[model samples]
Structures are given as C-alpha cells and as structure tokens.
Target: MARASVSPAPPRVSAPDLPRHLKRVEPARGADLLQATLHLSGDVDLAHSSLEQCLLTADAERVDLTGATVLDVAAKDLRIASMSLRNAGIRRLRITGGRIGTLDLSGSRLDELEIRDVRIDYLTFGGAKGSDILIADSTIRTLDLPQAEITRMAFVACRSDEVDPRGLRAKDVDLRGLDAEMFTDANGLRGTTLTTFQIQKLAPAIAAGLGIQIKD
Candidate 1:
C-alpha cells in the first residue's frame, strides 16, 4: 500500500511537435492559413481570421470560428461535423486524428491545448480561460466544462460518459483519466487529480453528495 498524491501535481502536457511538410490549404477560397495545411470540403468560415502556424486537414461538414485568432494551430485528419468557436482566441492548439460531432468553445480563450486520437461526440468549454491543456487518446461522449478557468489540464487515455464540470476552475487538474459515468457538478471536482482507484470509486458518490453517512 503505497499510494501517495496529495493532489496538485499534473502539468507536463506535451503534443505539438508540428511541421511535417506543410503548404497546401484552402480557407474556403479566401486563402491565408499561416504556415498552411488544410483541405476543405463543405462549410467553412474562418470568422475573424488571424491564424498562425496553422494546419487542418480533410473534410468539414460545418465550421464557423466566430472570432478566430488561433495561434500555432493543428487539426490533423479532421472530419468535423459542427465546430463553432464562438469567441475564439486559442493559442498553440492541436486536435489529433479524426471524428468530431460538435465542439463549441463558447467564450473561448484557451492556451496550449491538445486532443490526441480524437472521437468526440460533444465538447463544450463554456467560458474558457487558459493554461497547459491535454486530453490523450480521447473518446468523449459529452464533456462540457462550464465556466472553465483551466490552469493545467490533463486526461491521459481519456474517456467520458457525460461530465459537465459546472464552474470548473482547474487549478492543475488531472483526473487520472476518470472515464466518468456522469457528473454535472461533483463540486466541480474542486482542483482535480484523482487516483487511489480514482478516489475509491468516487467514494460512494462522494459520500452521497456530502450528506456523509458511511457506516453501512
């Protein structure tokens, strides 16, 4: 029995080794993809363009980055369904492999992001903030971090059922790849970093939501 982790200690996100021979884009005919690499299909509208070191690939069913200003972009092998970066301003982004149903960054402003081996159904970083973020081997069904103020996010070998961290203020988050069942507001998981079998399997639903009575 050697389980040590007084939380706070997860911020080594890595994934943004760009540059694999670029130059080949098509910003909906309005050209200009920084360090280019995009191959469009259907809908696209780089709203208030200003991307840098960009790189997006393959198909696109819909996309309208409202107030774009992405820096160091990357979305390899994309096959988007609906992407609406409402109030975009991302920095150093990276969205790996394909498959996205809906990704709506509400009032965005994320910095240093990463989403490897994707397959998202619906992801919404409601009122985003910034810091080092990473989500590896993803497979999210619905993950909406409402009022997000991310500091240092992390989720390796990820998997989500339907986790909506209400007023999420990730102060060095790292849920040990929780693979949640469901959670709209488990106190927004304070300042994450779970492991100890994931807090003993969520400690009986977090002690029945804090009513506390574990004497069964």
Candidate 2:
C-alpha cells in the first residue's frame, strides 16, 4: 500500500534590471525595497509597500501611493523645493526622522497618516479630506491647513510656530504638546484637546473659535 505526497509552491519572483550606479528594483505587486534610491518618471504607484529607508525625488505628475505602509522612511533630507500630490491616496503612512522641505499635499486624501520625529519647513495639507491623521514628536516651521477638512486628527508632542488655518475645518483635533501655541483657529477649536497653558498663546482672531477673549 502506497500513499501520495504533495510539494509546496515556490516563492514568486520578478527580477528587475538594475543600473550599475543605482541598484535595480524588483518591486512586488504591493511589496518593494527596504532601502534604496528610486528615480521615477510618470505615475508611480508603490502602494502597500513596506518601505524602510527610501529616497524618492521625482517631478512626476501623479505619484500614486495609496494604502501604503511606510516605516522609518526618512525624507528629512529631500529637497524637491515644491512638490504637489494630486488625487493621491495616502493611508497608514508612518514617517520618522526625515527632513521635508516645502511639501504641498492639496487635493489629496489621507487616512490614518502618522508622522513622527520629522522636521518640515513648509507643509500644506490644504484642500485635503480624510481622517485619523496623527503628527507626533515633530518640528514644523510653517504648516498651512487652510480649506482642509480633517476628521479625528491628533497633534501630539509637536513643536511649531507658524500654523495657518485660514479656512481650516477639523473634527476631533488634538493638540497635546509642548508647543501648542502655534495653532490658530478661525472657525473654532471645538472637539480639540490642549492644556490651560497652551490656550494662553492664542490671539483674539484665533481664540474666537474657542469663545475666549484675549487681552491685548
């Protein structure tokens, strides 16, 4: 009496033609490099790639990065000057220890976006619509969220000075950090979190949202 046996399936591989100076990329359907310098042209979609340390500097029109998981991807030294992300979907994005200079994410959507230990000079999340955006332990110079609609956003342990929210509309915005004085509100500060000392930094125009009169 004999029995039948079965073999396991081998791993899937799609090798790429790497450059001599720069390494080649054999990117998976939703998985990619851990650390590499990538140069792209046209629409680049590395969605759901668990990128560790990536250096991406491109002038592409639409970089389709949706539903991607970014861990420890440092863009702190990226000097794109001014870049735009249009109609791109960003979710579950985790950034740590990076330098971002002038990033404009208008007309984009973010879901569960988490940023930490980063220093951004000029960042604008304007005209963006999404939820659960957490920015913690970061230092930003100028952040403009004007005309942006956010849901369940949290800014924890962040230090900033110039935060412009001319037409900012948020739901459940949390500002729990040492430097929460930089935040100003025109619409209001309802469903927001802050300490008593942090609330003292708001001006008459900004404090109107919280129904508090500032003494000049």
Candidate 3:
C-alpha cells in the first residue's frame, strides 16, 4: 500500500509592527532623552547619548553606538539588521522582544544586560566586560562570549542552538532553566551551578567529555 504525502511546514512569521507616529530626533552627541519614542530608518550613530525609560523602534539596517552611554532603555518590536556597541557603556539595558540579526559588543562595558523574550540570530560579547548578565525567555541561534569578564551570568528559561562560552571568566554562573542543543567548549562553565534535572539532561555530554562509558 502507498502512503499519503505530507504537507510542508508554513513559512516563519515576521516580527510585530512598530509603534506609529514616533517623534523624529536629530542624532546628537550626549543627548539626554527620557520617556521618548524615537524611530530610526538608516544607520544610527548615537555617541554618548543617555536614554532613560525610552522606547526605541529600530527599523534601521545598522545601529552604531560607539563611545555612547545607554541607561534604562527598552528596545522592542522592531527588526535591526546589525547593532554595534564597541567601546560603549550600557547599564540596565533591557531588550524585551524583537528580532535582531546580529549584535556585536566587543570592547564594551556593561553593568546589567537583560534580554528577555527576544530572538537573535547571532550575538557576540568578545572582549566585553559586564557585571550582571541575564538571558531569560529568549531564543538565540548562536551566542559567543569569548574572553568576556562577566561577574554573574544567569540563563533562565532560555533556549539556544549553539553557545560558545570559551575563555569566559565569570565569578558566578547559574544555568537554572537553559535548554541548549550544543554547548561548545563547555569546560568554560566548570564552576557553574546546574540542577539535578539539568545534569541528567546533559549526562551524555558530560560522560563523553569525561570519557566515562554508560553501560546498560
């Protein structure tokens, strides 16, 4: 007997729409914006700008904030192709939901970086220094944190396809609710805290790394 043909999966849905009637502001150096809604279309260069409780709708292809300072900012509901924060300082950087292609924070300093409910294609924190970093309720395709100096790193209810934490030096690493397909160079997380369930899930990988055979 011949079997029936299966239908193909549907295409992925696009991100949500951005807010309308966002006030346009001239990109200036050291500008302080509070509770403002700004929109960007082309490449944005915000050097030394302070954003407090502001909503940024990034429709731009690239956002370059080299040598800038961002605080208490929330970015959501937009599609940014690329974001670069080289040599910038960020505190309380909360990104709730959005679709970001790539984020490069090389040589930057961050106090608190919180990312929740977002989808990122690629993210790199190489040569970056941060204190508290939390990634909760997000889906990341690839995350690279090589040579990062993070004090506290927590991954709560996050899923990642690939996480490369090689050369990462963190004081406290907590992996409470993380479901990763592949953790490259997992030895970087030697001092991390994992629950019994997480350990059970990673038993095969741990055993392979330690050259221990599991017999039935």
lDDT of 3 at 110: 83
Identify the superior model by lDDT, candidate 2 or candidate 3.
Answer: 3
lDDT of 2 by residue, 45-125 (tens): 665555545545554444444445544333333334444444456544455565666666676776666666777787788
- Report model 2's TM-score to 2 decimal places: 0.61
Off by over 4 Å in 2: 1-80, 178-181, 184-188, 206-216
Instruction: Give the per-residue lDDT of model 1 (tens digit) for 1-216.
Output: 999974566655445556677777667523346777767678988777777787777587997877788888777868889988878888878889899899888788887888889898999988888777888888989999888888888888888888888888889788787577777667788988777876776787688888888995
Error of 2 at 78 (Å): 4.7
Worst 10 residues of 1 by lDDT: 25-34
Candidates in order: C-alpha RMSD to true structure: 13.1, 12.9, 11.9
| Best-first order by lDDT | 1, 3, 2
For candidate 2, which ten residues in a row score worst on lDDT? 6-15
Top candidate on lDDT is 1
Deviation in angstroms for 122 in model 1?
1.2
* Positional deviation of residue 177's Cα in model 3 after best superposition, in angstroms: 1.8
Per-candidate clash tally: 0, 4, 1
Could you tell me which 10 consecutive residues in candidate 3 have the lowest summed lDDT? 7-16
Winner on lDDT between 1 and 2 is 1
